[model samples]
Target: MGLLMFYEYLDKVEQLLEQKKDIELYNYLENMHAADIAEVLENLEVEDQTQVFGLLSDEKATDVLEQINSEDFSSLIKALTYEKKVTLLDLMSQDDIVDKLIELPESRQKEIIAFLDYEDAEDVKQLLVYEEDTAGGIMTTDFVSIKKDYSIYYAIETLRAIAPDAETIYYVYVTDDLDRLVGVISLRQLIISPPNRAVDTVMNENLITVNVNDDQEEVAKIVTKYGLLAVPVVDDSNVMLGIITVDDILDVIEEEATEDIFRFAGTNEDEIYENDDTLFERVRNSVTSRLPWLIITIFGGLLSATVLTSFQSTISANATLALFMPLLAGMGGNVGTQSSTITVRNIATHAIEGVGIFKTLIHEISVGIFVGIVCSLLVAVAAYFMHAEYHIAIIVGIAMWANMTTASAIGTIVPLVFKKIGVDPAVASAPFITTTIDLTGLTIYFSLATFMMANLPK
Candidate 1:
């Protein structure tokens, strides 16, 4: 719904709550999607959130629980009795249950576990053993697999019986007698083929599978590469573990992208998700994430100051030189940041490898030179008109060109180097590039001015 509609809904909810019209509120929420309901709950008071949640049917409540934020989920779960909590959790997929349980305390986790059936408890325990960022952690155990010997008719029957619980039936996996993944058959293939055919005859033996320990990001890449609806997860022995659906891959992509963005901004996922209630707590969280990078920039600034100090005589002789310093430094920083952001994205997508790295560097350098020439000409013209000093104009133009070209090189190389050393390239991007460019740009600007003023005609 539109923002205005949601606001109108919120006002209606508040009014209904104020009048103690529980049935009316329940009726109002009946037609809403779980996601929209979750959104509404987010805007409500904690007590009202619990009250609204209580009015939902068990099925809707379970779906809503999966959709709400962790804080609201925590609050609502706490309000439920143990039996009710287990009932709701039982309706959730294994991976989703594990995801929700992770936000609770250890004791609460244990309590919730205690209430689950033995099978469900075991599955949750097994899933929890994998790191949250791994394929095993994100894959849902609810996948349909049939033995290779089963007739196509029987396989369809099996799917009919189990499809309700399966994450996706679009691609049903084929396994050996020992339950090792051997082949896969899509729903389209299943329906079009002769029903009496053996599954092995129709199934494609070639499979794209991820190991249980593979990073979620790597899993996303494979899914996108193949345009798969779901990919099977396997153990090192090729035993079928679970399947990660396209929906989960989408979540991983969003999460990794968000994490990279936060890193580039000198914060992190924790600070982005932090729900501090007071201004002081918010300020403290902000400082904790941002202060370190600003400190690094401060030290970088000191190095820039040293360069300026060394060029004091040059600045005094042609005081006009200082006018264009900001332009040079700013342009260098902008170019460097652009190069670094693209390089980091390429690294994340595994697009730039050995030969590609050289190609990318060359490409960026060419672009930098092109951009530098255009920007330098404009700055040089501006300098000539403002100061009417040909020496200063030439100095500024040359400095701008050199600084921009060098900035591109630094931007490209720093991320590559960081990746080589096992650092996240995104985290090393903007701040590091900006600081390095600032120091280098000033040195270039001053050195060019110093040389040209001493040797060139005034």
Candidate 2:
């Protein structure tokens, strides 16, 4: 639903809740999609959220359960009866069931596993063995595979029998006698092929597959690069394990992007997005994530202060030089931040690596030189007007140019260095880069002013 429509429904739901009109509320929700219902539940009070979830039929309840966020899922699960819990778990996809189970404590996860039927319980246990950010973790084991030696007609028959339980039937995998993935046959291929031909005759052997242990971000990249609806996951021996659908890749993309954004801000996502956290708890997490960076910034600021102290004589000779310090420093910091943001994004997209990193550094430095020229001219003109001294204008202008050019180099190189050291490029971050620029830019400005102090009016 559009945001306005969602709010309209929320208002109506609130009114119904206030009036204690349960039947109307149930009927109203019946028309909404599962995702929309989940959104509404997130907005409502916990008691009402549980109550509304209970109103859903078992099928709709299962669908809504899959759509709900981790925190809300936990809250609603606690309020549900054991039978209802099992019913919903059985109806949910195996991957989604594992996701919800992951949010629980080990003991709680074990308890929930025991509630599942034998096959699903085993599936959850197997999925839990893989890291949550890996291809195996997000993949569904419920995919159809046919023997390569089977006739095209037999393959079609096999697919029909398992199609109801399979997560996707857009492409059917063909396996060897040893059950190794050998080729893939699309639905279109099966439809046009001769019925008597063997599955391998028409199947495409060229395949793109990910190792079960591969990172989810890499898996997402593969899915996007190949325009695949789903990609197969394989063990080290090329044994087909499962398939990761495009929907799961979308979630991975969102999760990774959110993590990078938080890291770029020099904070942790858990600090801000912890569901159902108390205000005090949230603030504590925020402080824990943010304090180290703030401390580093404080030290960096002190270093800038030391630069000023060293240049005290120059500033005392003509107080006007001090007036342009902030402007010079601020512009350098801004340019540095822009360069760092672009570099971090390139790293995230895997667009910059090896030789590309050098190319990017050169490109950013070239950009900085041009940007510095334009900014220097504007500030130089302004400085002359403010102080009525040509030397002051030249000092600020040259400092601006030098600082910004160096800032761009620092911004580009810092993130690349972090990446080379096996750290996240985003950890190079804005505040850290900006502070570094401030220290360097101020040093350049003050030192230049000191050189030209003899030219100024005594």
Candidate 3:
């Protein structure tokens, strides 16, 4: 539902709760989506939140819990008794349960684990050992697989029995008796083949799989590249551990994109969009998130000021030189930002072509040359009309051309170097790139001005 409509419904729900209209409140929420219900619950007082939740059937309540944000999920769980918490946890999938457990304190994690059946607790424990950003961490052990020796008819029978709780039965995995993943057979392929044939004869032995430790971003890429419904996660020995669905991959894509966008804006911060957090908490987080970037920018501003101060004589001789400084620096920053943004995406998607770095550098610099020509012509014409100083106009044009080309080159090289050194290309950052190019921009403008001063139109 639209935000306005949800709020409108929430107002009525609140009025009903105020009047102790329990049945009416439940009936009002009955038809809403679980996500919409969760949103309304977030806006309610703790007592009302639990009261509303308690009205949901176990299945519906489990769906609501899945739909809520982790912070709200944790807060709601804290209000529950141990028995109630376990009842909800039991209804959750393996991945959802692991995710919820991660939000709790270690002691609380242990407390909740004590309530689980032995097999469920053991699976959650196993999943906890994987890094959160890796395939293993996000995978669920809810997939269905059968031994390669099973006949097609037998495989169909086995899948029928397991499909109820399995994550997906669209593409069933084929493992050996030892549980080593050997092949894959789609439901369509299995149904079309002779039911009396052995599954191995119909399965595709050539498979693509990810190791448990592979990054989640890599997992997303593989899934996208292959147009897969899901990808199997296996151990070093090729033993099937779990599977990552496309839905989970989509979450990974959203997370990585948001993180990169924040980095580009120079914040190195996260959690900027948790609207359900308290006003004070949000404000505090925003301040902390932006503080480090502000500090770095200050140092960068000082460095820029120091460079300008060193060119005191040039500025004194021609005060017009100071006016052109901002134009030169601004153009350089704009070009560098464009180049770096494209380069970072190329690095992330592994789409860097077979073209050599020198070829790539030349192409970017050529782009800079065209941009520089257009911008410098405008600046030269503006200088000539406003100040009527041929020497100043000429210097401005040359300075712009030089600074822009240098900015483009630096932008392309910096991220590539970061990638080579095991740093994320995203971390090269717009602030860092702009700061570096500002230093270059200033030095170029002043040096060209000094050269023209020494030799032109004395």
Candidate 4:
């Protein structure tokens, strides 16, 4: 249904609930998909959310609860009765259960663990050992695996028994007795092969797998680069632990993108807009992350001011020179930011690998020259119209070219330098680039003005 229609249905349900009409409300909620019901619940107040959830059938409630955001999920779990909480945990996928449990306080986690099935509790405990941003943490243990010695017929039979709980059956893994990853076979291959064919013989032995401790970003990169449907997660011993499916990688991509965007804007990536997060809390989170960069930029601005002070005589002699100061600095900042953003994004996506630093620098310089020439010509014409002095126009044009060239060079180099030094390029590049351009642009503008004005005709 359309979003408006869905909201309308929720309106009717809320009206029923307010009137103590439980049966009709329950029927309306029960008939909707869990995702749709979760959407409806998301729009309601917390107390009403709990009331609506309380009226859902146990199975429906569990499904809908799992679809909500982590903060919402946490709130819902808190409002649920002990019996309902246990039921919801049981119904969730192991990965989802572990994620929710990790969000709870240690005391609450212990209490919840006490009520969980022994196997489920053990699985969550094992997952808790991995850091949240690693491959192991996101993988689902519910997958079908077969012994290489098993016949295709036996593997199919095994899958039938496990299919209900397995996250995906499109691709099946084959492992040795020691649970060492050996090969992988698609369900299509299994079905097309003779029933008696050994899974080992039919399986493709060239399997691509990720180490359990590998960063989630690395895992996502591999999955995206190779177009994998699912990749196996292995321990130090190469024993398969679980598989991270394409769906999980999609979430990783979104999360990584969100983080990068926030970091680019100099904000803490974890900041969220929950009702419990007060205005001051939100401002503190944003400000603390951004303040360092602003401070750095201030220092950069001070340097630029010092440069202009040293050239005050030139500015006093030709007052028109000051008119182009902002234009030069602004253009330099833009060019630098553009180059930095492109290089950083390329590095993040692994599009260019093992390229020589000098070669990249040379290419960027060439690009800067072309861009500088075009921008210089445009600004020179504009300056001619703005200033009556031909020498002043020429000075501004030359300064624009030099400043832009310097900005582009610094932009390309700073991120590379940071990457080599094991710093996150996105977080460091912006403030550094802007600061360098401010200093360099001012220096170039004043120096060019002093030289051209001294030699050129009025």
Candidate 5:
């Protein structure tokens, strides 16, 4: 439905709930896709959400539950009866089931695990053993695989039997008799080729796969770089374990973006709105991430103040130099942030690759020089108009030019430095770049002013 129609439907659903029209409400909600239904639930009161969820078919309930945010899912799971919990766990994919289980306390997770079927329970247990941000954590074992010695006919029969449970059938993995992943064959190739052809005869032997221990972000990079539909996850022994599908990679991208954005803003990565954390709890999370940066910026501001104080005599004589101090510093910071954001995004997207660090820095410096000259000229004119001192205008202009060039160079370099040191570049760049610009900009402004006052025409 169009957004307006969906809104209208929500309004009607609200009215039906108000009248306790359970049967009508259930039927209406049942017709919507799980994601759409989850959206509707998100808009409803918590009590109403529980009621509406209770009315959904077991299959639909599991789907809708997975579509919602984990915090909301936690609340929904808490509201469910023990029997319903068991049913949902049984119905969910192993990867998703493990995710939900991990969200619960150990006691609760154990209880839920106890209720699962033996195979499902074992799968969830194995999945939960992987770190949350690794390939093993994100992949699902529910993919079709065939032995290299198998004939195409045997593979087709196996796929036909397991198609309902398989997460993907587009590419079937070809493993050796030892269960080592050796190759892959597309379903399209399988259908066209003769049934008697050995799996090894048709399979592409050079397969792209991720180690189970690879970081989820790295997995996302591989998927994006290779334009893969699905990538296999294998153990150290080359045993095929699971596949991370394109849809899962999309989730990883979104999650990484959200995390990077939060880190840039100096906030904790997992502060979702649906979390029932108190105001203080949220503040604590934010403060823990932000305080150290603020402390460093505080020291930086003090250093800037000291630099300005050291040039008090020059400022006292010119008086107008102080006005441009803030402007120069602010502009430098803005330019630096721009460079940092662009460079960070380029790194994330793999647009700029394998270039020498010094070369990249030099390129950014050259760009900065071009941009700085243009901006410095504009600021010089503005400074001249704002004051009568020709020397002050020249001082401000030179400071702006120098500061911007330095800022841009630092901005580009800091992220690369962080990456080289194995720190997340996005999380470390913004505060450091801004502070460096503030300190350098102020020192450049005042020192230039002192020199100009002593040498220039009066």
Candidate 6:
């Protein structure tokens, strides 16, 4: 529904609640989609949110919690009593329970775990052991796993028996006696096969799965590459751990994409965009995000200044070389940024497939040469127009070509090397590209000037 309509509904519900017409308010919101109800609750004051939460049926309340983000849910987590929190949490899937608990402090996590039933506590604790970025962390253990010896008829019966608690029934995993994942059968396969056929006969042995310790990004790629509704996660021993659903992959994609963008833009994501952050808080965050790069670039500038100092004698002789410093550094910086941007994206999405890294590098070289030739011609023309020195113009032209080629190489290689070393490519790619290009481009310009003018620096 439109925000206007939702607001209108909220107004009517507020009136109902204020009149102590509990049944009327429940009736009004009970049938609404859980997302809409969550939106209404999110917009309400904490006291009103609690009142509405209290009125919701247990199932509806769980649905509402599932729809809300971790940050927004923190308010309710703080407001509810430990006992009330335990009840609501017990009703949630283990994945949701763990996610909510993570938003709290260690003390709160301990207390919440203490409040859980023995089995639930154990399950939640096991999930908490995995880092949040791993497939095991995002996966839910609430999936169907059946023995392969069972008949198709028996499999159908068993599926019906456990369907209520299973997160998704589209694919039923088959495991051996030791609980090792062996195969999977879709609901359609089970239904279409002869009832008396063995489960193993119908199940597809060729399966796609990710290890429990694999990064969530890998899991997201697996889902996207295979077009799966859910992918089974397993241990190194092939024991089924859980399943990551497409819905969770959708969330991962958004989070990772937003994170990369924030990194590339040199800012914190929530601090910059979140309205709830106070002005002071955003300023603090923004300063930290940008100040580090500014500091690094300042040092890079000093290095460039040092290089220019080495060329003092060359600049003193002609005075024309000083004018073209900006030409070399400016073009190199721009081209390097472009190259790094493309490489970082390819790395993030693992998009370099049939083309291969070698082919991609070759293609980048071809592009760099094309760009260099065109830009060098312009720089040569500009140098002649400004200095009217043919020799200086040729030197400037060669230097532009060389520096741009160097920029392309640095831009393409820095991010790839960072990825190899387990550093975030996005974190270093842009600044590194710009800094290195400027510092190196100056050396190129000065060296060319000194050699061309036959006036080497002392």
Q: What is the TM-score of each candidate against the true structure?
A: 0.94, 0.94, 0.92, 0.92, 0.93, 0.85
Give candidates' CA RMSD values in order: 1.9, 2.1, 2.4, 2.5, 2.3, 4.0
Candidate 2 lDDT:
0.88
User: Distance (Å) between predicted and true CA of 117, model 6?
Assistant: 4.4
436 Cα displacement, candidate 1 (Å): 1.8
Off by over 4 Å in 1: 81-83, 273-276
Q: Is candidate 4 or candidate 6 better by TM-score?
A: 4
Question: Residue 458 lDDT in model 3?
Answer: 53
Residue-by-residue lDDT tens digits, candidate 5, 1-458: 57997797779778989999999988988888898888788888899889889999999998997787655777788898888888887777777767666777888778667878898788778888899899999988788898998899998998899877777898899998888999999999989889998989999998899999999999999999899999999999999989999988998999999998988876667465443578987877777877887887788788778877888888888677778777888888888888888788877776666765567678788888888999999988987898657877888888889998999898898898888798988887887888778878887788777777888878
Q: Which candidate is the best by TM-score?
A: 1
- Tens digits of per-residue lDDT for model 4, 116-209: 7898889778987899999999988877899999999998999889878787888899999999999999999999999998999989999899
Q: What lDDT score goes with residue 229 in model 2? A: 97
TM-score, cand. 2? 0.94
Candidate 2: Cα lDDT at 234: 95
Which residue runs of candidate 3 sit more than 4 Å off their true CA positions? 19-21, 78-87, 271-284, 356-360
User: 1 or 6, which is superior by TM-score?
Assistant: 1
Expressed as tens digits, the lDDT of each residue in 96-166 for candidate 1 is 87887777777877767776789889988889889999999898898999999999999999889989977
In candidate 5, how many Å is residue 333 off?
Answer: 0.4
If both were scored by lDDT, which would come out higher, candidate 3 or candidate 4? 3
Worst 10-residue lDDT window for candidate 5 reads 267-276
Over 291-364, each residue of candidate 2 has an lDDT whose tens digit, in order, gives: 88888888889988998899888888779887888788888988998999999999888899789988999999
Give the range of the ten consecutive residues with the poorest summed lDDT in model 2.
268-277
The residue pairs that clash in candidate 1, if any, are none
- Candidate 4 lands at a TM-score of 0.92
Query: Which stretches of candidate 6 lie above 4 Å from their native place?
Result: 1-44, 52-60, 77-91, 111-117, 265-276, 353-355, 382-392, 455-458
In model 4, what is the error at residue 435, expressed in angstroms? 0.4
Task: Answer with 2 or 5, whichever has the higher TM-score.
Answer: 2
Q: Residue 52 in candidate 6 has what lDDT? A: 81
- lDDT tens digits, residues 1-458, model 6? 89798988789877887898989899888988888888888777778887887888878887888887665566665677787777777777888877777767888788667867898798888998998989989988889988999999999999989888788999999999999999999999999999999999989999999999999988998899899999999999999999989989998999888888888766647555444668888888888888887887789788878888888887898787777887788888888888888888998888765557667677776788889999999989988888558888888899999988888888888988898899999987877788789888888887877786775222
